[model samples]
Target: MNSPTAPRRDDRPQDDRTAHRTILLRGGDVHSPADPFATAMVVERGQVAWVGSEGAADAFADGVEEVVDLQGALVTPAFTDAHVHTTSTGLTLTGLDLTGARTREEAIAEVRAHAAAHPADPVLLGHGWDAARWPDDRPPTRAELDGATGGRPLYLSRVDVHSAVVTTALLDLVPGVADRPGYAPDAPLTRDAHHAVRAAAYAAVTPEQRTRAQRAALRHAVSLGIGSVHECAGPEISGEDDFTALLRLAREEPGPRVVGYWAEQVAGARDAEKIRALGAVGAAGDLFVDGALGSHTACLHEPYADRDHTGTAYLDAAAVASHVAACTEAGLQAGFHAIGDAAVTAVVDGVRAAAEKTGLARVRAARHRVEHAEMLTPETIAAFAELGLTASVQPAFDALWGGDDGMYAQRLGTERARTLNPYAALLRTGVPLAFGSDSPVTPLDPWGTVRAAAFHRTPAHRVSVRAGFTAHTRGGWRAVGRDDAGVLVPGAPADYAVWRTDSLVVQAPDDRVARWSTDPRSGTPGLPDLTPGADLPVCLRTVVDGRTVFVRPDE
Candidate 1:
C-alpha cells in the first residue's frame, strides 16, 4: 500500500458569477468523475459554483445560506435512465407481481390471489412471468388462467414486453387476435396479437389510474437518485395521449424529468414534425427494427441454437436508411431497437448509406442511436464508431439474461451467448455508450447495472468500475444531446446525489500494486470499492438543479 496523498486545489470559486444565494457542501470525498479529487462543492443559482477541498469552503461561504456536511458519504452526479416505460413499470410496482412465481401452478395461483384481492377491479393487469427457469418450462394455459380468474379479464406480460398471455376475456375484446400473427393458445402473444391485446388492456385503464401509475414510477426514480429518464413510447407500444400526459405531468409536478421519444418509424419530415407536435424528442426509441433475445424475436443472421428460426427483422437497409435520412433532414435524432446481428447490420448499413447521401457530419450531429445493440459484429462496432452513433444499452440485460448457462446461452448456445453485449469493444472503438435499465423489462437498479457492466460474465468483455460509472452518468447526458451536465464540475447543473457508502476512493489505472488505496503523499485517489459482494451505495439525498428532489431524514 502507498502512503496517503495531499488533496488537489483547483481554481477557487469565482464569486463574480455567484448568485445572491449559495450552498456549501463540506467534509466528504467527492468522485466528480472529471476531477480525480474533489472533497466539497459550492452550488450557486442552480449550477456548480466551485469544486475543491473542504478547507477552502470558507472562501466560497461568504454568501452561503446552507452548509451541508456529507459526513464522509460518497457524492457523485445523479443518474439518468436513458430508456423506460413509465406507466407499465409503475403498474408492476403498485399492482400484481408474478415475476417470482417459479412454476406454472404458482403463476396461476398468484393471479387468482391478486384477482381475489382486487375483486372490485374490472380488469387484472400483471407482468413478468418467465418460464425459462421453471422445470416444466411452460406458462399456465388460457383455460387454467380462466379458471383462476373466474372469467375476469387478465393480461400478463412476459418478462420482455415483446410478448403477453391474454386471458380469453381479453381475447374476446381483441377480435381477430387468433388470426393475427404471434397468437398462440398456450403461449404468450407476440407481434400483431400482442399489440392488439396490449391496446385493449391500456383502454381498460382509467385516466386517473394512468396518472397515478405515471406519478408512482417517477417518484420511485427520484428516490433512488435518478434525475431524469427518457420514456420510450410509440404508437405500437403506447398511445399518444399517454405519452403527452406523461410529458405534461412531468412539467406540472416536481419529480424526475421525463424526456420523451415517439419510438415509431416515420417516413417523411412531415411525419417527424407530427411526432415533435406530440412533444417527443424525436420519432425514435423502441422503433423495433427487431425484438428481444429472451422472446427469441431478436433478428439473428443465424438460426437459434434451440430453435430453427433465425428471428424477425422488421426493416432492411433501405428502410433504415430512409428513416435516418428523413430524421437527419428534419434535424432529429434517429434511434432503433435492434438486438440481433442481422438487425444491427441493417441499421449500420442504413446509417452508412444515409451518411453517404447526406453527410457524415450531419448524421453525427443528429446523434443517431440504436437501442440494445447487443449482438454486434466488429464491422458493426467500427461502423458505429465511424458514424458517431450512441448506444442506449441496458447492462442489467446481461446480468439478468447472460452468462454461460443463463437465458442467452439457453437461446443461442454457450459459444454465441458469451459474446452477447460486448461493452468493452464498443467503448474501445470510441462508440459513445449510454447505460440504461430499460425498465419494465428490468428494475431500476443503477448500482446493480454498473456492477454488472464492471464485472461482466466474460473477463475479456468486462469494463472497469470507472468506465461503467462514466457510461451510466456522463454518457447518459451525451445521449440526450447535451455536452454539459452529469459531472461535478464548475458551471455545470447542480444535479447530484449523496450516497451512504463504506469509503470514497476512485479506481486508478495503476496495476503494479496488488491493493488499491489512496496515497495522500502522492496525491493518488480511487473510485468506490465496488468489487463483487460489495454493498452498493444507498442514496441519502438527491439534488436536481440545486433543489432537493429526494432526501433522507438526518440520522
Candidate 2:
C-alpha cells in the first residue's frame, strides 16, 4: 500500500484548489434539463462539470476529492429572490414580530412587551401589523401606542411598509413632520411623511446593529436555499451607509450573493455614475411611482372603493419618461415600484416614450424592471412585452391580499381585484417574470413563493409549478442581464440546493397538463409535491459558486 502524505504546495495553489474542489453528488435525483433521468452530478471550478445517470457517474467517482451521497434527496438550482430589503429583513427577524397579533389591543400588548424587553434600544421598532386582517379592522392609534410605550420613541410600520404609525415621541424626532404630505397627527404616515419618519427611525440604528441585522438576514436566506437576493435600497428606504455596509458584509462572507439596486432617478451621466459608485446594478428598485394599495395610497385612475378619492401619484408620465430616457442614454436599467393601474399606465407610457427617443432596440436591450406590477392592464402588459420590461413580482401579495374577500378586493372591489397579479397574462404576452418575497414584507420562503405562484388565488393568474420555479430561479438572473446562471447545465454557475422531500411529482395548472407532463416519454423531471397543505421541501444543503454556504444541522 502507498504511504499517505500531506498535500504538497507544488500540486496547485491553495486558493485555486479551494475554488475548484472536485465533488461528485450521486444516488439522488438531479433536477437538470440536460438529463431528466440524471441521478448524479459533478461540480468543479465553480461550475457544473457534468450531469448524467448514476451508471455514468462511475467514470468520475475515482477522480473527485469529495462525494456527497444524496440518498434520494432532490437537487435543484438554488432560488434567487429578485427583491429584498436586507437590513429591514434582519431587523424584523430579530425584533418585535406583530404579524400574528390579530387585533389592535393584541398588537399594542405585543409592542408594550417588546419595549419592556428591550429598554436599552433607543427606538422601539416593529412590523407586519395588517389592520385589514384584524377583527376590528382598525389600526392602533398613535396615542394608544404612546400609552403602550410609556412615551418612548416607537415606530411600527404596516404590513406593506408604505405607511406607519409612530408615537408622538418618535414624531418629535422628525423635524416639521406635520408639514409633510400624507401626515396626519393621529393616523399612520404616508407619502413624504412616511418617507421622512422612516428615514429618521432607521438612522437611529447603529452600525454594529445594522451589520448584525444584515448578517442575520443573509444567513437566514441561505438556510432557505436562497443563493442570491437583490437588495432594494434607496434614500427614502435606507441610507448609503446601511446599503454599502450590507453589500460589503456579503462580499466578505460566504453567503448568498447580493445584487444591489439603488432606487434613485437618473437625470444625466453624473447621476448614473453616482448610482454605480454605490455598487448598484441599476438605478432601479422601490423608485416609487406610487404607494401601496392597502394603504389606500396606490395611484389609481378611479377612486378606491373604501376611500373618497384617487390615490397619491408620486411621479407622472413626464417624470417617468425623463428618468427612463436618462437611464437608457446612460446605459443603466431604470425601474419603478408601481402597484396600481394608473401607475402601471405611467410606466408603460414613459417607457414607450423612452423607446422612441433612445431607439426601441436600445431600450429593449436594457431590460428595465417594474417591481410589484400587480395591477397591470392587458394594454400595459402588451406594452411591457413590446418594451422588453421585466416584471419583478411577488406572488405572496396575491396569496395574502388577493381573492374575493382580501384586501385588494376591499380596496378595489371584486371586479378589479380579479385582475391583480396576472402572471399568466404576463407570461402569455412574453413579459419576463422574476419572483421575490419583498422580504420583511412577506418572507424568504422560496418553495412557498413558488407554490403561491403556482396556486394563485385567481385561477386565471395561476401558472404551472415548473414555470413558477423557473421564474424564481433563472428569471432573476435574466433580470440582472445574466443569461448564463441559475440553472444546473454543464457550464452554468454551480449554485444549487439539495432537499429532503417526501416525493417528487410533476404538477401543472390542470389535470390534463399534469398527466401529459408526467408521461414517461415526456422527458420532464419532477419537483417536490407542492399541493396546498403539503409539506415544503426541507433544505439539506445549499451551494453557491461551488461553495457550501449552508448545511442543515444533524444531516
Candidate 3:
C-alpha cells in the first residue's frame, strides 16, 4: 500500500511539527464514521491533534490562532473514492456529456449541440450515453447516428464504459474496424470495438485541454469533499506516459491525491519485472475478467435470459491464474473487473489457485481487489472471505438500477435478478468493502453514494448509514493501505467533511424508508434534520487538510 501523492499546487511548508497555524473546529457533532460521533476537533499542521468535546480544545490553544464555530453541524471524515477514472472524469466535465439522454433522439440532439459548439472539422466526440435505459432498448445504429449529426463522425459511449455507439463516418475513419470479427455481431460496439474508437477520440485531446479537464474534475471532487481517488485508467484508455504525466501534475498542483492503476491487455506480459517497475513508479495494474452487464457481456454461469449466449470472458482462466501468480510474486496487488456470477467465480478461483501456489499469507498482504462484484453466488461470496479479497463497488449503480422494474429483471429474469448487487450479503459474509463513485459512469458525490447504499431498493441489501459512510472513508483508505486517512484520530491527516445535517444514521420508520418522501423535490431520503422539525439541508462548507482547500460561499 502507498500513500497518495500530494497535490503539486500546495505552497504550504511541509514542516509538520513546527508550523505556526493552529485551527480549532468547535461545537460540531463530529461523526468520524470510523468512531462514534464527537463534539469537536482540533487540527495542527495538517494532522489531527485532538478530537473530543470542546473542553479538549484547550490542549492545542497555546498556539491556536483560528477557530471555526460549526454551530453544532455534523462533521465526518473526508471521503476516499476507491475506484474512478480521474482524467476521464475530468475530460467528461470539460467535454460533451450526454448522461441524461433517455432516447436515441435525445442523445443525437446532444451530440449535434456539442458538434455545433465545438465545430471540429474531422470528428465530433462525446461520451456518457446509455441505451440500456432508452425507450427502444436498442443502441442507436451507425445509420441512425449518421443521420443525427449529418455524418459528422460522432462517437458516444454508454454509461458503463464497456460499450460505445459510433456513426458510419467515425467507423470509416478506423482502419480495420469494419472487418473486425466481433464488430457487427456484437451489435453495439464493445470491448475491442469500443477500444478502437476511444483511442482515436482520446488522441484528439491536446495536452493543454487534457490538463484543464483534469484540473476542472479535481476542483469538482474537492467541492464534493472527496480527498482521494484511485484513478483506474487502463493502458488502452491512457498510455503509461499519460499516467506518469497526470500523476506528476497532480503532485505539483492543488488538487485531490491520485492513485494510478494500469489496465493491461496481455496478462502474461505482467511479470515480476513489470510489477516492480509499476510499484517503483507508484502505479498498480488491473485486469478485466469480463465486460459489463449493460452490454450483456459480464461472463455469467448461465446464458442471459433473453439471449442464447453466456457473457464473454475477456481473459481466459489460464491467463487470469498466471496474472494472479505473477502479481503475487512481484509484490504487486492485482484487481479484476468482475460483474457477473461467472466472472466472479472465475476470478475467485483464479486468485485462490494463485494464492495457494504462492502461499496465502504472502499474497494476502498485497490486498488484491475485485472491482464491481455486482453479481455473486453464495459460494463465490464465501470465496472472497476465504481469499481475503476486497470488494470495490459503486453504490450509485444500485440507486439508479435496483428498482423492481429495473434492468436486472428486464435482462436476467426474476431468479437471476435476486443475486444482483448484494452489498449487505457480501458484508455479512466477511468481505472487506471499499466504496467508489466510478465517476463518468456515475456522478462523484460521496454523500449521494452513502444515501444510495443506505436506502437500497432491496431491503435486505440496504446497509446502515454508518457502514456506508465507513465504506467511502475508512474502508477506502484501507483498500489503498493508507492507514492514517479516513479517520479523525490524533496523528491522522486533517481531511474531514462538515455536513449541515446532524447524523447520516437513518431513523425513519421502516415502511417509509423504501418509499420516496412526500416531497419528491427532496434529493436525499431519510436525511437527519438540519433544523429540528425541518428537512436536512446538508452542504460542504470546507474540505480541509490542516488548511482549507475548498470553502463554501456562506462560510
Q: Which candidate is the best by TM-score?
A: 2
By lDDT, the best candidate is: 2
lDDT of 1 by residue, 343-373 (tens): 9999999999999998998888888889989
RMSD for all candidates, in order, please: 6.1, 6.0, 5.0
Write down the lDDT that model 3 would get. Answer: 0.72
Q: Kindly list the per-residue Cα lDDT of model 3 for residues 1-555, writing each as its tens digit.
A: 442222222343344433336778887677653334467787777778777777766676767878888887776677888888767788788877888888878887777777778765466767777776888877777777777787777768778887888888777778998665348743678777778877877776678777877788878887888877788866666765567667777666655667667666324444445533552212233467888877787888888887889878987656667777776666556778888888888888888888878998766676778889898878888988888788999988887776767877776887677668888888889888999978888989887787788778776788766578779888987786566677788888777777776444443334323443334233222334222244434556545466565666766
TM-score of every candidate = 0.94, 0.96, 0.88
Better of 2 and 3 by lDDT: 2
Q: What are the lDDT figures for the candidates, one per model?
A: 0.83, 0.89, 0.72
Q: Which residue segments of model 3 deviate by more than 4 Å? A: 1-20, 33-37, 265-286, 502-537, 542-545
Number of clashes recorded per candidate:
14, 0, 7
Model 3 lowest lDDT segment of ten: 3-12
Model 2, 162-239: lDDT tens digits are 999999998899999999999997788999999888888888899999998999999999999999899999998999
